[model samples]
Target: MLEPSIDALQEKINSKYTLVTLSAMRARQMSETKNPLVDHPFSHKYVGMALEEILAEKLTIADGQKKDSE
Candidate 1:
């Protein structure tokens, strides 16, 4: 199965820690709200879905916060 690359996702974020934190936070949000940034179905697991969203640039981190956040 195809998977999102950690290297590529890392390039979009500041650091490895930030990427991990962002993905975890996004996965939690997705699991709690059942809302996803990406329209197409990718993965059943929230973490994988979050990673896919991050790789696609649908989700982004800004100032240590999710870009979708105000």
Candidate 2:
């Protein structure tokens, strides 16, 4: 059985397949119903930043035509 924490994490990140998401997914998969895969050793330090980086790479927001000074 997987741990509650891992299950929660999987639910939190399974939808989007980004780095952070994938990390969580992997954790969930590794977890055994009620046991965390790795104690979430580095979850906080990287999850948000990793997700942001993945989104930045995938998204293509256009630059504003107007000058910042204007």
Candidate 3:
């Protein structure tokens, strides 16, 4: 089972599949030259950034839980 936020993220992604295509185009453009939203491959960068942000947020949440436990 997916966590609620992760599920929400997936929904956001499913709803924005068109954006994903655009992002892929942007990524390809970046690979060929440059793009402001993403400096690296757009598709990979988009997913990577989303995952990274989620991980970081989860870490913060975990730290909060630890502090509360202490």
Candidate 4:
């Protein structure tokens, strides 16, 4: 079973698009830093690690902002 299941993840972020975007961004950072925010992560990959962080409530989206007119 996946450490951080999609169904569980959805509870953290309602939007799948936002979830994907947020995870990808965090994965990139983890790849660079090589640090695991959560202890004993089940997945070794950065993407999975990122998701775990979200599941554990270690990472979060503060707020959303609208783009201004050009």
CA lDDT of every candidate: 0.79, 0.36, 0.39, 0.83
Model 3: pairs clashing at backbone N, Cα or C within 3 Å: 27-42
Candidate with the greatest TM-score versus the true structure: 4
Instruction: Write down the lDDT that model 4 would get.
Output: 0.83
Which residues of candidate 2, in runs, are more than 4 Å off? 1-44, 58-70
TM match of model 1 to true structure: 0.76
Model 4 clash pairs are: none
Could you give the candidate ranking by lDDT, starting with the highest? 4, 1, 3, 2
- What does candidate 4 score on TM? 0.83
Candidate 4 runs further than 4 Å off: 64-70
TM-score, one value per model: 0.76, 0.24, 0.31, 0.83
Error of 3 at 65 (Å): 44
In candidate 2, what are the lDDT values of residues 1-70, reduced to their tens digit? 5222444443433333333445455445434344332333333433432333223332212345332233
For candidate 2, which ten residues in a row score worst on lDDT? 53-62
Q: Which runs of model 3 end up more than 4 angstroms from their true locations?
A: 1-14, 38-70
For candidate 3, the per-residue lDDT at 10 reads 40
* Number of the candidate with higher TM-score, 1 or 2: 1
Model 1 local distance difference test score: 0.79
Model 1 pairs whose backbones collide:
none
Write the residue-wise lDDT of candidate 4 on 1-70 in tens digits: 8768899998877677877888899999988999889999989899999899988989877656331221
The CA lDDT at 40 in model 1 is: 79
